[model samples]
Target chain A: MGSTATAKIVALPMVDKHADPEPVETKASAAQMSAAEIQVPEPEPIPTVSLTKVFLGLLGYVTRERMITALLACISIGALFLFWYLGTKYRLEFYIRFKNVPTPYEVYQQLTQVGLSNKYLFNIAMSVRRILLGFMIATIIGVPLGLAIGKYERVRDFFMPVVEIMRPIPAIAWVPMSIMLWPNNEASIVFITFIGAFFPILLNTIHGVHSLDGVLVRAARCLGASEIRLFMNVILPGSLPHIFTGLAVGMGVAWVSLIAAEMISGQFGVGYFTWEAYSLVDYPAIVLGMITIGVLGLACSGIIRMVGVLLMPWLAFAPGGRR
Target chain B: MSMTMTEAETHKGFIDVRDMGVTFGANDNKVVAVDNVSLNVQPGEFVSLIGPSGCGKSTLLSIVAGFVKPTRGEALLDGKAITKPGSDRGVVFQQYSLFPWLSVRKNVEFGLKMAGVEQSKRNTTARALLDLAGLLSFENHYPDQLSGGMKQRIGIVRALATSPQVLLMDEPFGALDTQTRVVMQEILTNIWQQFRISVLFITHDIEESIFLSDRIYVMTARPGRIKAVIKVPLPRPRTAEMTDTPEFMNLVQELKGLIREESLAAMAPEIKDRGLSGFGMKVGPKGVGEIF
Candidate 1:
């Protein structure tokens, strides 16, 4: 394309010079001269940037709102640390002393101690594995069942009552039943986590499928798509945004149930670590476990969001999207 | 080209609506949406259906597109009944129904892909059509990235991508602004000139109907049936300047009168029930009725 433009520029004056005779000589030569000048000069290399200017340029990109947000976050975190310090230093009240709340510095020291210990890493890995396994099981079962119920009224009618009845029962409440049903503590804990994750994913998937644009389905039909093709191409992709919402919510719930189940039944997990700390009166270790759970939950939800953005570039390009 | 000649002789591209009627609800609650409507489009002819709102213009278009079945009669394509939607009859809806999930080029290639056209071939064909519609540069963009006009253009090209025998458009440009609609009309005209596919376009706009169609089928207000089949005496390769001519204005005026009369007739029952003194008072001096 670039070569064609150069060829056109070179050819235009030659044609003008040949077609008209009077004052074309200087004009044609001038055009040729400019074209030659353009061809002769190479593009300049990118200039090297000084360190201070580069730093300032990077700093300039951070808007005032972002700066304010960062400042507010820092102030809030600082306030939390100050409150913790004062509360622990003074032994504030009965509940605070009974709970044995640790100072931020004590918790930080405990975190470093735990980080150095192999048991702490093992507990984290075990907890993460349990959550992932339970979440995957829930997704595999929920997505297909949800799609069926959403797409067909008869299927929905058959399953909706059963789902509604079972959904409200808390994962902790299922601990006794899961223990009786399953052969081992591992299976029971996983079952509890799966129960926690399943409802959210299923409900969200149903909502996603229900909210699919009727025009999209009709348009697919008009395009000569068969039933299977319509489901695969239109229905599945169209409901993706809602499905991602479900997955993210489900991941949070799965972790919640996994920890609860671990506290009651587990031998080696983060929840077990926290429960043991409570029994041993290690307040700082308990705080370390709580912080670990919070950080892990955030990371897991962030990963789910990233996956959603990857699957739906259209959503990424939409107004107010992360992209 | 010779195949089209043979098909023309055999009425291949022809769309025949034989006493087609559609009713909704049951017994006492029944509403006659389209009443014994009959119309036809000849091979390679552009026909527009114009009527007031609630007059089942879209219902009629839907019948031809095979989305809705006629309660009584049937719509035929090349003497065969249209029971379900197929690639044989391509439809362009009032809402630009381009798939939001798909890119512009992929949306155009959808029907072709459904027909099991090889990937490379469909891609080439889609690219050519997009290029013709001046949307080639936006091939990678999703439908959400496009303006209303650009999306409608993509809708048109998507419908045409399959090379369907008859193109059924339901007020394809109704949602666009006046300037965009005019440009779209010209683009549609150019496309029609090249393909010469039989079209049954539905629109309430009198001037638009007169501008694009070879013949216009005017329907009654409710329980829509053919009231008039006005033939446009205008020449093809129609430009925007043609709409300013005496002939175009005369046709517009004539259509306005027909529509106004039907619209009034449709509202007569309501007017009588309300005991409004003047029957024709609601109609403005410009011949535009507010019934719609």
Candidate 2:
């Protein structure tokens, strides 16, 4: 058995020599056979669908689901209007005290009139501008500060106590202090709005930077990444998903605070419009202002979400992100 | 094993670890990870360090890669002491460390990008390496989009991108299934043959060590020290068929015997605490059964 084993070991080189050509010969013959088969006539390619056909297909695809949802929404609105109309017209127990509550028809008339009025447009535009400016200011400061705190333990230790103390105070509570702090009413209102949006952005960004995978950092270091390169390439991009989440939440809070700030201080905004309508006992106009705020908030949040999806195509294409 | 050598003379070995040791913690809590381990890898030679779990094989490799400092002696590459991780010595971890945010091609080109290679050159090098691993089509795919085997292949190609002199692989195929493991081993052998780079591989598999290495270093259990150095006398351009040959089986049996003996020795303390009857018996389907 020992001799046989020795003989096989000695013949291993001969086996390797023979093995090389055997695979090449088989591969060459297989390639030739495949090439010969490729000479046969091919089947006709499937015709491309027309653009109009694709559009119509998409329209059909969306309209079915959307139509059902739209119908359901219309029914819900109709039911709510019917209840309000019956309660207000017949002077029901709850409606007896709610004499200021306008009928659905009156509210609709006010809505159409408000749509044509320049005052309504001015309030919306002013509110949007103030919210945008406040949110931008908050984001610019919050992102960098959060990143620093997350990346450096010394920075975190120094700033964390101050942030923790200030974060939980409501934006409405800031109204008195901001008014005294800022030189003008506009600045104070923006300050309150900034306060509202800042914490969410800061906290989420810190979380994002803190939760970065250690393995990725090590891998980048081994690959010769400098400190700045590591931060820019690994930390920044890795924290993006959380940053986007913060932005969306911040956007919602910005609108809330903008309206609150406008209501408390001298302002021509959606919040002031609602407050003025209430003092004038214009019930239909009050409902109109509420609707306008709702629509504006929805649009702002939607835009933020769209931008987030645009920035992170990878996340958009990930398994759970399927539309 | 030669003790006396002048620092001025050029070393023949690409990586030389001399009496290296690592001790974690301090005073009463001190734990020796590696103890007086010395080894060398000649230029273009493939060497493996195999041992039971917690044998400090990984720590030894880490010291060579410059990620960890040895408390005693030192690890040298090209006769220079390694103090920190550098692109010259590439490491492939058991966990697929490919960045999930980057595409496969970009991950492969990461080291080159860090070295400030021009974009076009990076693209060409990345494409070539991807094509070599038969993953050119997967260049645009993210790490998570690929299978475990494909991710590891990308990891290997990523390490090779900078053209490192020595490749440090720590159980690169340990996470793979058996079939993928075999295929990966073959791919690795092919790449190593072409690159001809010195490699210091750490693994727990005896068969893998024998199959891949020119010399296998078996290490003792924790407080790990080199127990044996066995040479694999197989012919070059090793084929899978060689694994089934009589010579291969004999070498495998011999190595298994050595490993089993060491394993038993490592288990001796536990056996003494539990008693031989409790140590040998294990819960089986029918009832307690003899495990040894």
Candidate 3:
């Protein structure tokens, strides 16, 4: 057997690299008689590293990562500060026309006042409760439907057309229908919120379930997992990242639609407070409402993110952490 | 010595697959993956199915594992026809089939839990398997935290956790680097010897089959059929040194010849035609005749 010729090139001598200018038979046939004698040169020794070198290398990596984050944060904060100072200093027409452009300090005061007022907290709590209720209901309906649609072609075919037709219509558009369909005004608002959040959650869940590795399912089957066990053990856990994705998206949609729903429903909520302030042209209160919505949206999304981190800590360190 | 031909003969196969054919789609749209393939794996025997990528080796393994049913013919375990997947057979996939969400211990425990092995026994079984795979310390770590070899080891442990009668492996170490793959082969050989589990391993690598299998079944492509089944007369408890022997080399060469022909056959039609799609061979005159 011509082993040398067929063998992959494994090595070269160090001095041979610098000095040699020779041709040799490296063919497998030439080495057949003494296959054991055929040898590849040893690889160069790795450079030794001291403890200081190792420690410094790790330090450099950490510092570089943190520095980039710090730089981006500084730039964004600086930009925001500049915009606030300039908008108030020159009194921009947009800010002036609304007369609701509270200075940074005034906005802070309003934030504190909203935080302190029991009634304010109550309204905020009510809005959050409504959002939660609607979100919870949508999740219950949407996740199972999404999973079914994802798993079964027949189920998908039956439900997809109806879902597609309903998916595009704005959640606000459902307000009147919901009011008519349900007896209570609160139910109508909740329905609108559900409509707002349902599609993204359902769509993402379907995608997640559909995108699961078929081999994993096969693995589960061979392991003697019953149908329900397979879903719980393999399918559900596999699609969880997508479910979290849907929840985050659904939460965002819920916030956007909840404010709109409250505004339209003429309810005792933050949206109503904002509308009332607008009717009276109370500028600070309007500023308060916008900031409240912004902060609340941030807090809700943050909560969703925190939940995601807690559930799938491994995912946070995955190739690229999107959140 | 107790070793005798009659003993070998009396060692009845654990699974019998006779003239099994798996064809996808229907009638005019039909495509055959495995065609009239018959195989028998005896108790504690290590058998490998080797061929080109499209030679239905995987399909055949899947049929044995009960992941897919043969369109025609029967696959039986201990004389009874197999229909659906069961805990009796465990499969390790090529793609390090460890569940990313679960820790190493948990992944192994999955099959045990399915078998309804109580929590106490499950932990013990999981730990033993993990220890056998040399991954006892990584029990608490998720699949992502492990290297390719470690993940594959976990996969093996997971498959064996149910204490299945047969272990079906589909190129389980195909994704690992060359060095890691060699190490894993050794690890697998050790595990197989320890468990004495009947195995139906599949691979495209010629040398891999020679290194690990007791007998190898070479397959033809497309509407795949078994071309040859050659018994490897190498002595058992094979070591790394055994792979360098003249006998092993000769076996590797023989297997390569079979695989090389199928590989060329598998691609012959594709190279012959400029426009080709799945299973649809466009007959054209720019054809290169059989390489063999």
Candidate 4:
């Protein structure tokens, strides 16, 4: 067998990359006598750290293509700022009902001044508080309700009709009714925010549960998991990815509802400040409000994403962390 | 060893199915999956059910695993009726059996945890089983990170961690590549030897059934019934080298003939239905004859 294998290797001079290593070693087949003589190569020596390796390690898989896209995004944002400066510098109106738009510098100047004001900070805090309160309540009620609705046909049938009816009504449309229903202005605004947050969370949770593989449930049962155990071990974790997605989407809608409600009836929120600025003809404050809202919303979603990553460590295993 | 051969053959088994039949729907829409199938697995025996597709081999295994109810007959495990799934019977599904959310070790320890076993004992048992599968190094890895063969190995280990009376595998190697499938077969045989538990294996692979089983039960086409039960005369501690010998090849040839006959018969009706779809025309020369 050894002689025949040697003869074959001579006959076939080129490398057979696809050849099974068990029968013949790749680089050392000529030196080997038999399959058992196929030796394992020694592990490569650890080399001193290279700058490129460290750089790549710090930012795994940041392809040149992605960098190009990031650069383009930055350029577009720069052009927007330039256009705002140019437009206000000359007071140019390029149609589309353009008028009295504040210059980028004017907005920046206003932001610098308002950055330290106690009333501005208080308004931001108040808005954050209302949004958090509403969202927390929505999550507590919606997740369990969604799980029940998804798990049982009876719960689904009972709740679905009412949800469907209420789902399509915009949160702003509920402003009049919410004001009448709630005794206080704060309660009305929070109610609107809750309405915005609840439906998406509920629907996504239901979808998450419904879409779980039935085989997992069967596997759990055969493994001796009781019904309650099955729910905890299989159903909960199985549907969590979808639940997080629901939460992220719900957060965005909640902000939109919260801002709208505050504009309509709020006395001391960021939204109310923007509306007050418009009433008092303070144009720079309006742009400041928009910037604040955008920054706050991004931070809110970022926190949710961090929480999701922590909860689902398996799915979010960073490159070079654990393979 | 406690029971006589005759008694084990006729009365008791780790997994026993008696005149089992499962059918879905009613009236015109009805589909008969299994028809009057009966089989038994003695303690420490390895049994394989080989048949054409849609031959109810999986349905039979599901009955034994207590996933599906038998429509016409009954299945029992250790003299107790198999009503619903329990930890007494461990099942390894063909694919996606491992929980994606759990690490390999956690997946293995799941049944132990559910059984209310204490934390330390559960971890030790899971570690031991993972070691048996030669997967102790990959314990922290999620199922998503493992290859097809590795995932199935974890699946088997997870199933065995519960220490069930019988291990029910449903085409566990069907989705694997040819090379991986062969390796998985060897690993399974090794596990079976060490564990010494009854296994009711299901597969369509003729060579696989012959290589792994103490007895191979061949089933007919739809409304599947036992067509033959050939006891493997091959010696224990079977190896890949045995496949080249006349005995193993002869068994493979014999099983292949039986299966091909059933497979052709199974495809014949469907081929005709396809021909009928062409405006009730007769099947031309480009019909079932050319189909493998």
**Predicted candidate 4 versus true structure: per-residue lDDT over B174-197, tens digit per residue:** 988786676567667756755678
Per-residue lDDT of B276 in model 2: 52
* Two-chain complex of model 3, DockQ on C-alpha atoms against the true structure: 0.20
Please give the ranking of all candidate structures by TM-score, highest first, separated by commas.
Answer: 4, 1, 3, 2
Runs of candidate 3 exceeding 4 Å displacement: A1-71, A74-78, A94-100, A109-115, A320-323, B1-13, B273-292
Supply the global lDDT for candidate 3.
0.77
> For chain B alone, what TM-score does every candidate structure achieve against the true structure?
0.90, 0.90, 0.88, 0.90
* Model 3 pairs whose backbones collide: A2-A28, A2-A29, A4-A28, A5-A27, A5-A28
DockQ of each: 0.18, 0.26, 0.20, 0.28
Cα lDDT for residue A281, model 1?
90
What TM-score, over all chains together, does every model reach? 0.85, 0.81, 0.84, 0.86
Across B48-157, the per-residue lDDT of candidate 1 in tens digits comes to 99998899989988888888988999899889988998888888988888887899999999999999999999998897777656566678989876677778878987
Docking class of 3: incorrect
Fnat scores for every prediction:
0.33, 0.25, 0.38, 0.40
Q: Which one wins by lDDT: 1 or 3?
A: 1
Candidate 1: TM-score?
0.85
- Score residue B271 of candidate 2 by CA lDDT: 80
Best by lDDT: 1
Residue B251 accuracy (lDDT) in model 3: 88
lDDT per prediction?
A: 0.82, 0.79, 0.77, 0.81
State how far residue A210 of model 1 sits from its true place (Å): 1.4
What are the chain A TM-scores for all the models, listed individually? Answer: 0.77, 0.75, 0.76, 0.78
Root-mean-square deviation of candidate 4: 6.9
Residues B1-292 of candidate 2: C-alpha lDDT, one tens digit per residue = 0111233322233999999889999999999999999999988889999888887999998888878889999899989999988888888999898887788999999999999999999998897777666566568978776667678878987988887788899999999777557556656775676677889999888778878889999898888999999999988666566789898888888888877877877787888766555556545655545555
Query: On residues A181-285, what C-alpha lDDT tens digit does candidate 2 reach at each position?
Result: 999998998888899899999999999998887768777878888888888888888888888889889989988888888888957999999999998988899
